[model samples]
Target chain A: MEISSKLLEKAVAEMSQLPGIGKRTALRLVLHLLRQPVSQTDSLAQALQELRTRIRHCRECHNISDSDLCEICNSSRRDRSLVCVVEDIRDVMAIENTGHFRGLYHVLGGKISPMEGVGPQDLTIASLVEKVRGGEVRELIFALSATMEGDTTNFYIYRQLEGLPVTLSTIARGVPVGDELEYADEVTLGRSILQRIPFEGSLNR
Target chain B: MEISSKLLEKAVAEMSQLPGIGKRTALRLVLHLLRQPVSQTDSLAQALQELRTRIRHCRECHNISDSDLCEICNSSRRDRSLVCVVEDIRDVMAIENTGHFRGLYHVLGGKISPMEGVGPQDLTIASLVEKVRGGEVRELIFALSATMEGDTTNFYIYRQLEGLPVTLSTIARGVPVGDELEYADEVTLGRSILQRIPFEGSLNR
Candidate 1:
């Protein structure tokens, strides 16, 4: 609150500007840094500075990278023909950690949130459509979040590729793998039943 | 978890090394920074670097400062004969926020904790003894935490100042203001009862 040092106050103010960090937590963190070796703060500052200055986005999918093309887009082992669309790089990382999909990703940067003034133009929708029109992607999978904004973005993109030759698909919506049916939301449970897959087909996944 | 970019991974690693931050929270913060303007990140990094590089400690009290003497030590209004000894600058800030103390502070940097390999030699105990020996401070107030380590540090300092011509006292322990009696811990309640002061003294405070 009443910090004695101007330098400490400035550092705390800057740190509290970050999302989810409050003034007290920021003070605790700044105090912790003060107790640590100067090299720790030097490395932390260097990492953050480099992240902002040198970070790049893949020209194809718009995922964060250090070079023009991201690692996923440049990999030959991934299925370039199958593109899974996501809201941001966090989603890409989440999907990649599952190890279930071999397809490459197309990061849209964010969903179509009209309330937040983020429209289709604010995202990478146009570039994604261009990628599909290049004829290399045989299937474009909609893997966005299951929110209204996610659905709107998917529909908007689907309309843009209406007459295209590429096949369109979306990830299955159902109760999660380890979740109890009773605990699942009504909409998800109903959708799971309505779009139930064949017993033999489910065995493979 | 499975971050694709090396720079992103490095930044997340450094950010998560802070107290109470985890990998997921670190990723969330890093992504939030990526979404913000580059100037925001630049300022945050610059502030942290400057705090580590340019901050100074007061020669008299050891509180963090921008010059040789801290604001408290430089102030002529503060009582020169009374000193409140604390564990660190955080305590100094906390006490200053209360706006009740008008005495100078002596920061010990840390309390004595033998289990953590911290001893009297690791703290500013020698400097504190020297201050008392200088004969300007007529009273020494112990304002350290009410923990075993804090008490040990206080007792150690009391022994060091046994023959000095100075009055020594510790802060009162009691049910905090606005706290319910039923909720007060036994140790504090017992101490409050044992060290009961005059009823008129309570009315004045």
Candidate 2:
């Protein structure tokens, strides 16, 4: 589109660089910003700048944090021995919203996707292994997605801690809690049947 | 969702304030920005800040511009006797993209929507009438949307120029160039049939 102003064009270009935002949507956003108070734009810019410049990652979990240690890792109430491994901060937020897990997290940042040139070394796998080898972590939960990349990352991490004292486990794959069995995918349904737990165990949960 | 850091949470909150962006999407975008180089975020922030702080509106047309007069208003090649009235800068961009209209524009800023507490005075209608009274414009073309608010805004502006010498016209309403007849809406299809142009005129365009 032929934008009249260079400043507006530059703003829209930068906005469209974000994932899922196209040129039209970017223009709409920039126009909306123009209509609002300058302070609103200033606040947005300040927040984004501060987030990138001052944001820190937890030394232990590799999650985004303002300090050396993240809130999850710093909290004494959370079970440090039970570490849930996830792909990124979004997963950490999702699991935290569920309010089911009571353990600390190990954010791998991303999976080992060969197609994307992200190998095991690109992730936080080395630090995770070191955490397990440190002997404090009693259980390492693989909470990655069900994609092939997720499985590959899990197996790679598992191999790295073959003789470690920590017990390895993965999130269950099956029909969702409130979903009907008929709607479940064949692979998930078959796996759920093969890995069926005791009736009492299901009832207890 | 429970974010680990206050800085990260603030950024997500600010990002979510944008139109069409939800909390989850905001978190995803924020995380994506966190993963990229700090300079990328800095550039985005800088562009937005400069756009908001330094952007100016054309004194004659009220369109976004870097200077007091917009490029369109400043250009001598554009028709000085014709003016297309539009709802916002987006419409100006859309018309300019067509490369057909060489007339200047008068941006209303927004339609007169009483439901949203917007009135005739809220727009740039007075300046448009003043432009017509100045006697330079020989024709005024209404290029607003087909919505009720658009019609109302057009009528309000038309009423303001009651005794003016300029000829008043609206953009032709008809079926879109490549639209299927069967899928066209009843109102549009009926209007297209009622306001049918001569076959030769349609064929020529």
Candidate 3:
């Protein structure tokens, strides 16, 4: 009954530290990995090892990149004047997947959250201000989560760029696609109510 | 949009191979790893690499172990004469968690399935027969899945040990605790019917 083995215990402990994984789940994941072919596990190991060593933050906008500048920042085909500001590199990828937005991106690394002891100085706000000060940017879209902390961070950024030429805006929040009103959470319902729009063609009809 | 980054793509692709995970989940896991401190990702990579290089199969029962013998096999307190035959190491863990079983185990790796081309020769059944014939074992318990393939494999093994003096039996099957009949699937219902137990007391009384 006792897991006396050092290697197995160590692997389980490591897996338990991952998000949403417990000790039992960690054991299952470790044992599953142990059963798979050695080559498949080796590939995962190599990928994880290279994730930190090979990847770097884009020098201009702090997006994840293997080179000095990220692919989005380096592309001349993108709308250089319009930049979408996000909380992390993952948001950058999500925006990139929507082929409609042909604009540049600025990754803020994280949002300002006083409860978590995170402040504007701890993030890439200075770099963003510097980018805005350069006078090439037109519109700055804030595509952050609709949490209170996210809003606080967005407001802080907006105040920091006061009198700057960039027009700041945020993504609309409402019921998600394929979801009905019955399942929508209270906060989403409230926000959708507050931001309700007038029907356009129906007014004329 | 195309996944322009090779390293990110590689990491996501490798992660997607895990059970119950798809491309989107792989991307989420990769992005989560990317956001973490470099040391955390390094630890995961090191653990994954060590899992392959450090863990080895037990020579006796084919269970995963860091040494020549597994923890269960090496324990002196367990009943060595009562061997519980299982389909994989997962079943061994499940029975061990109950803390009722005080016996040894033999992992058959997989069940006999002619549809997928797996046969008796591909299993550890021959070694099991040899272990029983060695005169140390007294009883051989079949603790396999309740699937048709599992039943077929159990019958095939029973035929192999027909002349042996060892006792053979299976675990009980019926309605699970805290489960409703409405949620029960057809296979479980059929199994419950076939393996029904006699009434301990008259419900009418």
TM-score against native, each model: 0.96, 0.97, 0.87
Once fitted onto the true fold, the runs of candidate 2 whose alpha carbons sit more than 4 angstroms away are: A201-205, B201-204
- Candidate 3 per-residue C-alpha lDDT over A1-205 given as tens digits, one digit per residue, 9 for 90 to 100: 3454578777777767766667876777777777788888889879877976798888988887878888888988999899899998778877877776898888888899999999999899998999999999999999988889899989999999999999998887888867999999998989989998786866322
In the predicted model 2, the residue pairs found to clash are none
**iRMSD of prediction 3:** 2.3
Candidate that would win on lDDT: 1
Residue lDDT tens for model 2, A9-123: 9999998888888999999889988988999899999999999999888999988889999888889899989999999888988899999999999999899999999999899
Tens-place lDDT digits, model 1, residues B1-205: 7888899999999999999999999999998898899999999999998998889999999999988899999999999899999999989988999999999999999999999999999999999999999999999999999999999999999999999999999999998988999999999999999999878745635
Instruction: Please give, for residues B6-96, the per-residue lDDT of candidate 3 as tens digits.
Output: 8888888887787656787677777777768888888887877787788877877877788999988899999989999999877887888
Please give the C-alpha DockQ score of model 2: 0.89
Q: Compared with the true structure, what per-residue lDDT tens digits does model 1 show for residues A1-205?
A: 7887889899999999999999999999998998899999999999998998899999989999999999999998999899999998888998999999998899999999989999999999999999999999999999999999999999999999999999989999999988999999999999999999878755646
- Any runs in candidate 3 off by more than 4 Å, and if so which? A1-5, A174-205, B1-4, B177-205
When 2 and 3 are scored with TM-score, the better candidate is 2
Instruction: Report lDDT (Cα) of residue A35, candidate 3.
Output: 73
What range of 10 consecutive residues in model 1 chain B has the weakest lDDT sum?
Answer: B196-205
lDDT for B50 (candidate 2): 98
Worst 10 residues of 2 chain A by lDDT: A196-205
Candidate 1, position B31, lDDT: 85
